[model samples]
Target chain A: MQDALHAALLPQGLHDLLPPDAGHEAVIVERALASITAHGYERVKPPLVEYEAGLLAGVGAADRDRIFRLLDPVTQRTMAVRADLTPQIARIAAVRLAHAPRPLRLAYTGEVLRVVGDQLRPERQFRQVGCELIGSLEPTADAEIIALAAETALGIGITGLTVDLALPTLVPALLEAHGITGAARAELETALDRRDASVLAARGDEVGRMLADLVNLAGPVDSALKQFASLALPASAEPDRARLFAVVAQLRGRVPAVPLTIDPVERRGFEFQTGLSFTLFARGVRGELGRGGRYRVAASNEPAVGVTLFSDSLLRALPPPARTLRVFVPVGGDAAKLREQGWITVAALGPVDDARAEAKRLGCTHVWIDAAVSEIA
Target chain B: MTPPPNLARGDLIVLAVPKGRILDELRPLLRAVGIEPEAAFDDDESRQLRFKTNLPSLEIIRVRSFDVATFVAFGAAQLGVAGNDVLMEFDYGDLYAPLDLGIGACRLSVAEPSDLSQSDDPSRWSHVRVATKYPNITRKHFAARGVTAECVKLNGAIELAPSLGLCQRIVDLVSSGRTLKDNNMVEVERIADVTSRLIVNRTALKTRPEEIGGWVERFREATARNA
Candidate 1:
């Protein structure tokens, strides 16, 4: 086998996160982590690889084959590259954070690999910057996570962003209230996910019809909330509905400034979401910049919620942040002085003409002369 | 249904098609439904992620089977074809799997080593630890029996679980059961018989009902003809 050839062709679902794109992605992640940190979300770095068993512990079957698994030569145990950071975070929270305080807030930024086909618009290797608020079932936690996500997006210059929200709890409650069995619930969710109202109407009972209708409701926050309120749901179903509404209300009261909408039928990405879920979309972007929701412990039944921004997607929708000081340090110039001024200086050793072109290419607003020791504005 | 205002008029209707085995099986089905993808679609060596179909209005994107649900659920692709396995795994609330294409036929089942099957009675078990690709379905299947199933999820090679002592039983899709037989496993319980279904984004279906519904009808007719 040609190792070089294989290396050159780099397998599907893996790619080199090259130069400026890589650098810019790093900067974006730093900013995201800073913002999340300022909100008292601490950071955690999980290993990029874990035992296959540990990695797959609570992950669903559909995602099993998507992981890049290989036998660890040292231990002879099967290991997998991280496909999602959430599970690892959960594992950490279960073990390490068990002794920690309630409502643990932790932030993470890292690469995740999924065995996606080469044809998907999303890259197989993409950066995710997110924060998980664990051990809290409070609706305020849900609202706060979403609010932070909105703020982080704005902080990164992602404007005109629309956050489409949903609740996993409500769907199940509605199914139970309508006497829909587990199997029927699965089928109805499948139907709702596909947006086939005809099928939903055909297969769904009265509750399915109402749930399906709610799943399709999307628009301004107030109207969406009113539509949900008018569902006239029984007392048993009220808590889930109230939690969903509370998250919305909290967002309105706390971060009322952010452009938020209530999408009743906005049944996007419920597979992993256990409670409140949302996807942030900006005008002109083809896909979501970030998406996440509460993830309940399948084993211990603990409550957890977090949001991960596809940094690559966010980068595409947002203009690179304005460069602070574009210092063009000429060849053999005092690199130390530019450092003192805290300028992002680019060192160029080419001819004077090439130096000018380099300055233009680097988008430097000012060039410093090496020999003359003068700054060129 | 009028096209959603968010979508540009000339924007092609991206169809999220699952890659690998299903793509191979779906090629004929796609053609049956009047979609002829570019030659590059057939070339496994191709690096292209998105491809154009013969229809100007339709483009095909090959994604993971799991992502087919996510893509369509989020309305990233207005349409998709995914197995019930993928459908059960994510169970996105907004997607509508209107028509059963009946391709990629298989069953989601609980299997154990043939040796273990002799002593194991699923009905008698109070609690069981199982490794599976489908935790939701597995949990639900066992929960119905009043058995607390501690499921250790694995992405693939579920057949290897029993031998490795990861778990005594595995829940996965059984097609020919060749993979199970090779691993000395036998089906102990059957979950749902699986098949690929034509899935559409609910919003896409509602807002562009006529167009999406027409496609659904076309696929329904195609499946009927095949049947």
Candidate 2:
């Protein structure tokens, strides 16, 4: 009994997806990928594991700690289980399809494994579905990715969705402009990451005042933009800010219905993002549904932007899917014919005295009786 | 954990507050922010966990200090008042401490018996045993300076550990010198300054910016007035 109990226990931050939820997650992933692929983003399937150096070359370097390492038996070299699919997509765009097109559009959906999980996202292994547009530096590319992410989420029934825009590099540029480095920079980084206002209150310098204003300036796009326009940024960061302004304007024109907010200092997950980035949120959802932003392809200079949605979080945002009508078909009944009419047929193994009782026992909503469908009730 | 049923009401907001000592300081701030909970909220003996405020859309829940970060971080409660000590211990990424209320002034410090500190040199020590509620912060503080800390967890009355020989040292919050003196202990090193902050859930601020940002602005004004 002790051995049996031990066998039932899985590793922490991992679990088996049982029954309807498992099926529901697959359907959602398909719907999401379909919506993304509809925009001519041809799908690509990357392996679950790859050579460590190849996997962790560029943008993937940030995720080195999270990737699970294993020694390949053949080459005796280290292999890493992919912690994020964006890097794998980047590798493909650089090496496999390097000469394909200027703006290569690729879509992928696969399970990713991590060494551990954070408190906000506790699933060490979960599916990521996303599309990346490579070899494009245009603000329109950023706008397209944002619009596609919103469209995919909206199409899948995530209500009251919000797309929060952030420029992760903006704050660092501001700090660098003021010669803030070493311990002081680290302190300010932590303060900004936690969105703490006390740091601003304590530091009364010109930079401090500017950062505080920016923190308060974070809000709805219209008002925040109005306030942001008056704030002056260093010349070195002007291009990034200009790109953001362009993307925001383009996004407003394209997907105006989706709510947009900007936080110039949000630098949590976009460690490698060089330009505009956005995180997707649905009202009342526990965490982010997905996030995407601009970056360079691994081992190459090709500019890219993509959005990766968490299937688990997306499931949380959506309502429990409508139950499929399962009709109990008698042993001799035509199961295939009933299935064609959109009824999930659960056939009887043997003849039953009462079809209604049998249907109720098998969790079916309907029963095939007298050559017609009848409600279980 | 399942969120509270009222969380589904987009118009309503929940503010989780620490139940004990900080409540006195928070009261005036709450009043300044135009929030008045029912009179029962002030009753120590009242077995209420939640109370309706003067604001029709806002409610307040009183919980343990540590749980305030937990509540707000999980989006179970959209807003909370938590100390920086608790915030540093948990270091929850979901919580954004946008305003420093500047209340609950204290310091998380390493404390040992008065006699031990007389001969003890913190820089010379390689390893030490401690008793405290904040093991994470204690371990981090010691590890930063090449000291390996073995912390024995104690929720309350941490000062009693040294006398009982459970541990020779402790890492706990020091508000005044009275408690350490009463327990025959002295502060060795201070880890971080402690103060309560106005924390908002990241997702809450993102999804309901207008409503949540409004509260943050109001709190900012209230704190500025106090300062």
For candidate 1, give the DockQ: 0.12
RMSD of each: 11.7, 2.0
TM-score per model over all chains: 0.60, 0.97
Q: Identify the leading candidate in terms of DockQ.
A: 2
RMSD versus native structure for model 1: 11.7
Query: On residues A226-256, what C-alpha lDDT tens digit does candidate 2 reach at each position?
Result: 9888888899788878988999999989898
Q: For candidate 1, lDDT tens digit of each residue in A312-345?
A: 6887876765555576777777777777877677
lDDT of 2 by residue, B58-117 (tens): 889999999999999999899999999999999999999998998999999988999998
Kept native contacts, as fractions per model, are 0.23, 0.86
In candidate 2, residue A240 scores what lDDT? 79
> DockQ of each model against the real complex?
0.12, 0.83
Q: Which segments of candidate 1 are over 4 A away from where they belong?
A: A1-8, A59-62, A117-120, A177-187, A203-205, A234-236, A264-268, A298-300, A320-332, A346-366, A370-377, B1-227
Clashing pairs in 2: none
